[model samples]
Target: MPFVICLLFSWFLLPIDSAPAVASDPLLICWNNQVKPLQNRFVQLSYQEQRNELEHSAEPWQQTPYQASGTIWVNATNFRQIDTLRNTTRNRTSFTKTQADTQTLLVKHGDDKLTSVSRAMLDEHPLTAARYSPIRLIEYAYQHHLRPDSASSTNQATCYRTTINQTVISLFIRRADGLLDRATLLAPDDMLGDVLTTLTYQDYAAVGPSQQPTRVIVDKVNGKVRDQVRLTQSIVTDQAPTLLDTPADYRLDMTPTPVATARSEKYSDHVYFVTLPHTDDRVMLVEFTDFVLVAEAPLNSENGELIIQQAHQLIPDKPIRYFVFGHHHPHYLGGVRPFVHKGATILCSPGNDDYVTYLVQAPHRLKPDSLAMAPKPLKLEAVGARKTITDGQFSMDIYHIGSQSAHTSDYLIYYFPSEQLLFQDDLVWIPKTGKPTRISTRQTGLYRAIQQLGIPVRTVIQSWPVADMGVKTEIPFAELAASVDSK
Candidate 1:
């Protein structure tokens, strides 16, 4: 009777469970090629779209360059293709350009991370790895073990998984298809939710030994299908994907990082960081609950590792523990390996194991480190649309956000109850005098979700510039919604 009452009461207001979590069963993928399973079972499964123009080279494309034309689903909603071309330079400057419908605005992305957007129906995705994460959910090729028939397959083949996490995911490509078509992510019983991005390959063609898709289309957030993919060109490279070098001009915005001066003061429970201009991309550290739970460690372990070491200096012997992930971005989560090394279980949202694991281990960057490879195991705590973490005096909650897969799927903006400190990320940056900028559907959607859920938030912390939190002056939520013209 006491245990039951305590459980209910805990949910009523107090802090929930605090035990080391467990590792979920790994996703199992087995194909009895002889079984030939029904294709319907596969969601958004992409095969090689066929084309009559490109020919199969007797040899696999070592550094082959070819062009393709087709349409892509701008989103799961209403999206159509204009035309497109791609220039593949050994995957070095692999460039792709697309024209929208009948209008202008060409969309192009060079290398992998060096992307440009000129009027595509979208901005960033709530889950940058929504598609990629699930792709990891399905296994693929590993290392340089090329399939015997890779060229004839035209980049179409089978593969397997070598790792999984918040960033770079790697798998072994078998039978030829480099991209995933048949794989299964071992998802926990709790993490299966809605499918965010869906891509359907209509047909395929042999482009220099690779089975390249000629008519590949995708589904938008609303579930609409596109017809053609004006693949301007296609290029195969022996080298790895091009990556953007870290900027030297960048410095860790420590306003929220707890400088030596502010370290001794105990204003709140745990400090929060909001990169929303007002403080110039600096983070605002909010001391919550007589303890601290650091959220989103992406500034990389190298830069912020010192923050943890200094926590002892500031809080004396409180024993720093608990780290939370804001959303699942490879770059950000790549920096999280440091925490994993510290034996901290990741606290995340439900329905995101597949995607989050992929980011935690997907392969996108060239240089590989132990951290980049998703070292130690992860401990996860999945929360509901409304869940809180309170140590009596200080309290914070994790709220649900939808239609916001641009940035991430396993996302939760931290909300402090007593201090009224609300930590919101990628949703709205406190404008200069508060003006909104070109935003994302996920960001805009999150703003609506917050108001609809009625989260009793006061001082909002935007954890990027590292120092962007302040006392509640006015209702910034309403103002932010109006800026996005949210309905």
Candidate 2:
């Protein structure tokens, strides 16, 4: 009787224990498929990238191509990438390096200036996170516990959708090999609204136990191909002993220092031309009896803050009442937020309302600036074809450069009638040697605008090349005409 009852119990337990092996979670399956292959290997990848100029240039619709080459080294605990970008059309070359350990991220850009920030900041900023390698992305996702909300399959691949903070990321895994085929990230932009950036990987090749894409194409949802990266080499090896070491000559700073030093030159009693420390960008500050007006907030917020500090030092008693930027280009308008935080009215060119509005209101929780820490409503005013700010005794005219200008349609130039000084940005680039090889349509456009506006101007001040050894910030109008009239 005991043997028969035991046999009956054993038969029922067999069915319960083997209930079809509960289908594995799709998210975990995909994650393991991608990560397990690269678990113990160190990947060294070298690639060359070709990018379109239209995405970053002042000249709209100009698709000039720039080339860049980079190498990335990734292991379990460390990541390092070095990129050299060359713009042959502009005759410029710059080098950048990004490296991260367990606790800190070190970034070196233009002029070999290294800045160290918290590694955790990458978690808060999606655009920065998107620049990482696929191996690094997998590590980041795993570390952050990013779980997929949904998984869907198509004929060719299965895609998993996940959200990291506010950024929406969709990862597509090829059905054949279960490798990452593409990744699309939707992140907010201050100027372009919500930008959909897609990275598609192709030509999967094996490096030791891991597989890497030999070609990667980056595209935007606006039908613009941002860049195409061709992988030249990939290998699995031990990390170099000095792979993450900073060069002894590189300037290292723990805090964000956009401007090393600022110098202000008094162009006149009311107008002072402030030159930024290390770059060719400049700002103009005009003082009134009761308040001050600043023109051309260039670069990032740190650059703007330095300019503000100089403005306060020059005019101690008055608040900054107005902030005017040249156009919508990032080099010109990027620093507008600092002015908005000071409760200044922003005077910008038409069609830039949406862009400027987004700049001030955009969330900066990752690294909060003065404006982000203390919220304020954006006080914006549009400058049409022409507008003038005057205290009756002094007048400065803001004129739109119009569509005839080859640079940007909504460009604006500031003219001071009393000082007989005209201030413009990127309209004319005069060489430091006061000579002309050839004339751009942009230079002639300025002459034509001056002729049509019929404003008397004796001197022209450029909002660039604040001081280039021999270059003068204020050039006589004749020098501009000579360049325009020259062969």
- The lDDT values for all models are 0.39, 0.69
* Model 2 lDDT tens row, 238-279: 663343465565442446535457888887888898877666
* TM-score winner: 2
Alpha-carbon error at 285 in model 1, in Å? 5.4
Q: Which regions of candidate 2 deviate over 4 angstroms? A: 1-32, 35-133, 136-259, 468-471
What's the number of clashes in each of the models? 127, 0
Q: What is the lDDT of candidate 2?
A: 0.69
The deviation in Å at residue 75 for candidate 1 is 39
Q: Per-residue lDDT tens digits of candidate 1, residues 1-487?
A: 0012222222223222222212221112212121112121211222222222111221111123434444333221112232233444333323443322222233445444323332222222212212222221232221112222211222444332221221122222343323334322221111111112234433444333234344434443213222233332433322221123324542223234333222223335466332322222323343444555666544344433544555555555564356666665422343455565565666666766654564444332223334445566666667767767667766667775633524454567767656665665455544455444455565566666667777665545454544344322223555656656843
- Candidate 1 is scored at a TM of 0.42
Candidate 1 at residue 47, lDDT?
A: 20
By lDDT, the best candidate is 2
